[model samples]
Target chain A: MSYKQVIYTTAPDPAIDPSLTTGTFRLNTVPKPTNVPADKLLVRTHYLSLDPAMRQWLTAKRSYIAPVEIGAVMRGQSIAQIITVGSDLSSTFQPGDWVVAYSGWQEYAVLGAKEVEKVVLPPGGRPTDAMSVLGMTGLTAYFGMTEVGYPKEGDTVVVSGAAGATGMVAGQIAKIKGAKRVVGLAGSREKCDFLVRELGFDAAINYKDADWRKQLKEATPEYIDVFFDNTGGEILDACLARAARDARFVICGAISQYNAAKPQGPASFMTVISQRVTMKGFIVFDYAKKYPTALQELASWLSQGKLKRKEHIVPGGIEGAPQALVDLYKGVNTGKMMVEVAPVSEALNAKL
Target chain B: MSYKQVIYTTAPDPAIDPSLTTGTFRLNTVPKPTNVPADKLLVRTHYLSLDPAMRQWLTAKRSYIAPVEIGAVMRGQSIAQIITVGSDLSSTFQPGDWVVAYSGWQEYAVLGAKEVEKVVLPPGGRPTDAMSVLGMTGLTAYFGMTEVGYPKEGDTVVVSGAAGATGMVAGQIAKIKGAKRVVGLAGSREKCDFLVRELGFDAAINYKDADWRKQLKEATPEYIDVFFDNTGGEILDACLARAARDARFVICGAISQYNAAKPQGPASFMTVISQRVTMKGFIVFDYAKKYPTALQELASWLSQGKLKRKEHIVPGGIEGAPQALVDLYKGVNTGKMMVEVAPVSEALNAKL
Candidate 1:
């Protein structure tokens, strides 16, 4: 018997093909492993996350992480269920244990025990939260906002890509942390409405609207004190123009300009000097030592229903992973976007 | 008797006229003051400081400060001598006392006693040092380099506009603060040579050279850890590209883009995220409470001959103020550029 796995077929120049059908990736069937290594475990992937950062991993350029090489398994994080425990780790690990790992776009993975993080779900957290709210996505939002943005109580916080996974979480975190007025920039009216109506954002601007720039000006009458930028383009320029004195810009992701051969910087960047603003960029991994403290607070907010999460989970397993990633860049998904690679077995006694 | 004063005659849009012949300003003949108000002192301008920030005052645009209004004496800082003291200020200010005041581009000014800061020359400091190293130019470099850049002992520092008053001081401060290497970006070969041989920079790159970017790359082989940027353009982009992890960018001034209607942002600004860089902008006035501490240290360095200052004095008095300002934007001045309005009165008891 064989198992399916997606392989990166080409390293795109400047930008990856947003439409994955251009032969940039190939779904290959590989023979199933007959045995697990003594220090490893055999696991079956349940859900594979689709993220904007995946675009950077497709190019042979220097970034936070190395690019996924051609003919290699596409890099991704996934929630998996342990199918077998290695002989050397039978006492510590058991079959049916749920763990989150870099299982990539594959049905099955053979991984060392240290390569996988055992998932002990907090209260109100579902299994999917391991790949969404309680995982890297939540951690990115947490550190990027609290540590870098440093939003004061009276700060008017503006979040771009507000309907997406990390962005929605960042905006919600801002509101929970006592931001005065939370404004969101989304790509569509539905997302904007969802941000305001469902997520408790004070206002939402659909960047697609013709009068979007005007709307931004009106929304930020006091000027933006804290800006958590996920998309960097004209929206970044507009935000820079209205930046309050000593505004803090948390540079998280530039989803809008990721595909451009020559990305344009914000035209109003000089405002950084005029307004005495500070722009800082950071990676979530930098705060790994403090993750427990952050997660404890995030879990409390989630358990109290103060923090809510929205997910756009794509079904049809690994085959849909490519298009799901493509759609991620297109802003087609609201909140966390992931592909359901497989279903958990009834025998797995996990509570979540 | 009449006095000559330069008045802003017209406001230019997009970009200011680098040529004073464009009639943006006019030399006006005004009557000499007959009397000083009770709270004012009649002053004779001696030395007028010309700065790149003057360009911002030429346009009717919002900035850190209000623009110079049409028909007003063009705003400037000058060292002046008290010629006559008002009755109310007679006890506090004596004739021939030297002071630094915003006396503008005029041969004489009637200023409030509070408007002028009495110039008490420090040991081994000359009268010109009041407007150069010990004045706003030096203060800007002090806080901007120390507080904003935070150059570490092993850090590789880079300074753009490194030949200018503020930039040269910032680079030296970085060296004094124990930076491992200091690289300077200058416009001309002469300026570049002066930065290395005269000011003791580790290396200097002439940005006007065709292979300047390559030179910058070679000079900062360890990568730029602290970048004090005074000129914002391709130079900023190059520094961003060569930025080391967790680099600090002190955005002091953008003389290169000051004249542009649409100032371009750094194209490689994404490196801010990739390398976790921090870019902060500031005004020297914000640190007014700490000015005494900064000035004391600067004066100490000056007295020990550790800190050096170079001034390009245009000898043709107030009549040349307009063209001197135009030449300033062209980067013709190597260090602190000032116009000598009049000879300091020998009656002044101020120490040299």
Candidate 2:
């Protein structure tokens, strides 16, 4: 069998430009592995998650995670179906079982049983949800808000990149936790409107608007108690300027700075001291032990309709992974951005 | 009776110049406050604490504490000897009692019983010790290290402004708490020597040295775990680059930025996200409730010789307050910087 894969070809010169292109990654066809190791399972990708962190992975510098080396299949997390199980792990995973795996930007992936997690989906739920709201993005928002942001009752919580996957969920969670007002900042007016109308945010400021700072000031009249920052740049500075005493800034991701030739530091950073604020940066994987409890609460919220999930699905299979990531860096996605590789088997869907 | 007082005449233009000058202050003789209010006591100032926070108080901006209004006495925390007490508070304080008071840059002050704290000295201890080792500076170092920094037994702790009032005490406290390596950054080689030899810091880097960054890299071989930052500028950026995962940055004071017209933000601030670090800014006032216990522990350390105290005593009494403040900003002092406004009364010394 033949499977399509995206491979990292070159590291971008952060000093010159950091635009993602086919020159940096190449599409290739390769023969699928014929024999799986006894402890491994073979997964056929259905959905691949395209996140801002992928841009960081393409760089040569050391970060929280290792860089995607040249000539290597690009790294990503995906929801895949176990097409075949090795004899040693046949009792653990069976054919047609859906799992969340670090399957990378490829149509097929071979993984050890420990590398993939079994997805326990709700009735009538799609497997794609397991790669988004019930997976890494949702868990990122969960721990970043509750643990780091520590939004208190009657507090005003401000979320940047509010229309994105994690921002949308983080704002809603703050509201559910009794935040008096939840304000959001998005790149476009339509996304801002979606955040306010669809996600039930108190107010949404279009960062693209010339009067966005004024809008943010007007939206958060009492100053922000917790700022869940995903886009860290001018928006982060504006938020810092209006931080109340002892405000908590949860730095989940800096999507705005990810693609910059030289990431500009926030000018109003001194507000971290002047306002006696606490800014904490964290990764979702750090709280792996607490994932089960987080998922249970998230699942309950989904069932009760207290939480809403959104995903922007790109139509092309594994070959479209590069453009999907490029579009993500351009702030083109409204919610979770994912590339659909294939449809899950009816048997797997029915079993879930 | 008459006493001399320093009054703020004008605010400094931080953009043009932030040097402390007598041009912004004037010394004048004033009648000593005599009639104590029903709940107040009359106190004679002895040792006036000149801190970096005083520079912030001169600026007409909102901070953790209100700025000193122009034409008002310069605000400060001081060790004073109570001279008389109101009838209502006679039971709580006596005439010869030493107390820590918000006495400002003056020889005499009238304060409410609730506004002043009685100083309890160890046997054979001088009243001057109360202003340095067993007072606000000591308390600040205690809480900022234990509460915010939360150093572990084998943690690599870095302290900036390592020879200042709070920094000296903070570094020692980290050492006493069993930190495996305590590295310090000071402005001069003498201060660095004092930190390493006198205060027992494992290593000290003279930030004024041409190769300070190289020295810091060599000193903190395992990267910093808990960074008690007192000076925030390039030193902070250098430290951020070498921070360990989940490192704690206790922002006690930004003495470097205190004088800047526009403080420069750290360029490597993204390390906060890349390393999953937590930077917390705090004021000593927040831990007021726990001061007594901190003082008890500090007093015990002082008596046991586990902690050493040093004070740069500027002479010329109250008339020298302005110059003393300027010298402080110039980094002329080694440890606690204070102006010796008045000598303790012979009667008070005999009573103790």
User: Which is the leading candidate under lDDT?
Assistant: 1
Model 1 ranges off by over 4 Å: A18-22, A345-351, B18-21, B345-352
Docking class of 2: medium
Q: Write down the worst ten-residue block by lDDT for model 1 chain B.
A: B343-352
lDDT score for residue B14 of model 1: 55
The top-ranked prediction according to DockQ is: 1
Model 2 stretches astray by more than 4 angstroms: A15-22, A34-38, A60-62, A343-352, B15-22, B32-40, B84-94, B344-352
lDDT of candidate 2 over A1-63, digit per residue (tens): 889888878776652122344367777788999999898999988889988877778772648
In Å, residue B305's CA in model 1 sits off its true spot by 1.0
Question: How closely does chain A match the true chain A in each prediction, as TM-score?
Answer: 0.96, 0.95
Residue-level lDDT of model 1, residues B157-252, one tens digit each, is 999999999999999999999999999999899999999999999999998899999999899888999999999988889899998999999999
Per-residue lDDT tens digits for candidate 2, residues B214-322, read 9999998899999999888888889998999899999888888887877766767778988999999888889999988998899889889999999898876887788
What's candidate 2's DockQ score? 0.56
Candidate 1 lDDT score at position A208: 94
Strongest candidate by TM-score:
1
